[model samples]
Target: MRTLVIGDIHGAYLPLMQALDRARISPLDTLIFLGDYVDGWSQSPEVIEYLINLRSSYNCIFLRGNHDDLCLNWLNTQQHNSLWLKNGGQSTIEAYKRITQPTLQHHQSFLETLPSYHLDSENRLFVHAGFTNLNGVNFEYFPEMLYWDRTLWEMAMALNPRMSPKDPAYPKRLLIYNEIFIGHTPTTRMGITIPMNAANVWNIDTGAAYKGPVTVMNVETKEFWQSDDAYTFYPNENGRN
Candidate 1:
């Protein structure tokens, strides 16, 4: 079975589905989602529902994202986060308004249970955002850090490419895993939308939350598929910032 790593969805249900269709994801393939399943265009609830149902067909590993934490805390803890609302929580709230309580609660439970990172048997690390330490640290301690650290990615990018693996300055995190996959930082921010490679890290977030395609990549081969621009799917709506 192949392993596919999907980047942030940000409620673009159509793009998400299109990416999956383009990738031809099957029941036997393992899907490792890098999170941000909600809060963007108009289909946050629909996106969550699709993922929930996917459990029956695929081996799915859903990592917790910062936006996901915002939504979950609002739902389960009844938080009134102004920052989250300003960022995209309002879109999520509106989407949930159309969903039933039972459905929202079920998805909430699943969200709360999601791990911050997943380490596969191949020693490949899957995380929504990178971590501070790669020494098998449990996310239960710094739950937020696991899903919100940019320094981890920056650290990888800052690695002296000239340094040998045995050098002391080499990132300790990369040594712990065969390869690391992350999505919190969108490659579009760098003025490009394709999956970008830096050192041994791969950034697959192609800005679907804003105006790029949702991406799905083959973990082993580094082959990838992308959807049409997510904004075109909802021509009348402006996705959240």
Candidate 2:
């Protein structure tokens, strides 16, 4: 069975569906999702609902994202963080208005159960962001950093392409996992709209939360598929632009 890794969805459900159809996903394929499943568009509620149902028929591993955490907090506490609302939380809040109470509770339960990271038997690490510990994720001191930290990606990018892991200057964090997949930081920020590989880390968040498309990549072959720009899917809305 093929192992496919999907990038941050950010409530662009239509593009997500299109990307999946383009990829021709099979129920037997193992799908690893890097989170941020909500926020930034008009379909956050729909995205969560779809995912909850999709889990039953597929081998899916969902990781929690920073945005998902904020949404869960709001659902439980009924309070808002101004920064979150400004970023993409407002759109999620608006979409959730149409959802029934039981469905909302189910969404909340799903979010609550999501893991911060996943380590496959092949030693591939799938995390929404990155871990800080030199010893790796299991030793992480701050749990939230799993979905909030950018330092791991920054360190990977700073490594010299010619540098070997055996070299003294290599970052310890990169040495623990055979491969690391992350999605919190968009490749678009670096002036690209596709998956990026820096050292052993692969970033697949192709800016679906903003102007780019939803991306799905085969982890083994690196073959990928994308939909049209997510913003184009909702021309009337800005979508956290």
Q: What lDDT would each prediction earn against the true structure?
A: 0.88, 0.95
Model 1 root mean square deviation, Cα atoms? 1.5
- Residue 121's C-alpha lDDT in candidate 1? 90
Across 1-241, the per-residue lDDT of candidate 2 in tens digits comes to: 9999999999999999999999999999999999999999899988898899898999999999999999999999999999999999999999999999999999999999999999999999999999999999999999999999999999999888999889987899999999999999999999899999999999999999999999999999999999999999999998889
Model 1 agreement with the true structure over 1-241: per-residue lDDT tens digits = 7999999999999999999999999999999999999988889999989999998888999889999999998998787899888777888988888899899999999888888888889888888988775574463357678789887778877888888889887777778777889999988788888998877889989999888899999999999999999999999878864
Q: Each candidate's TM vs. the true structure?
A: 0.95, 0.99
Candidate 2 lowest-lDDT run of ten: 164-173
Please tell me which predicted candidate would have the highest lDDT against the true structure.
2
| TM-score for candidate 1, residues paired by index | 0.95
Using TM-score as the measure, which candidate wins? 2
- In model 1, the worst 10-residue window by lDDT is 133-142
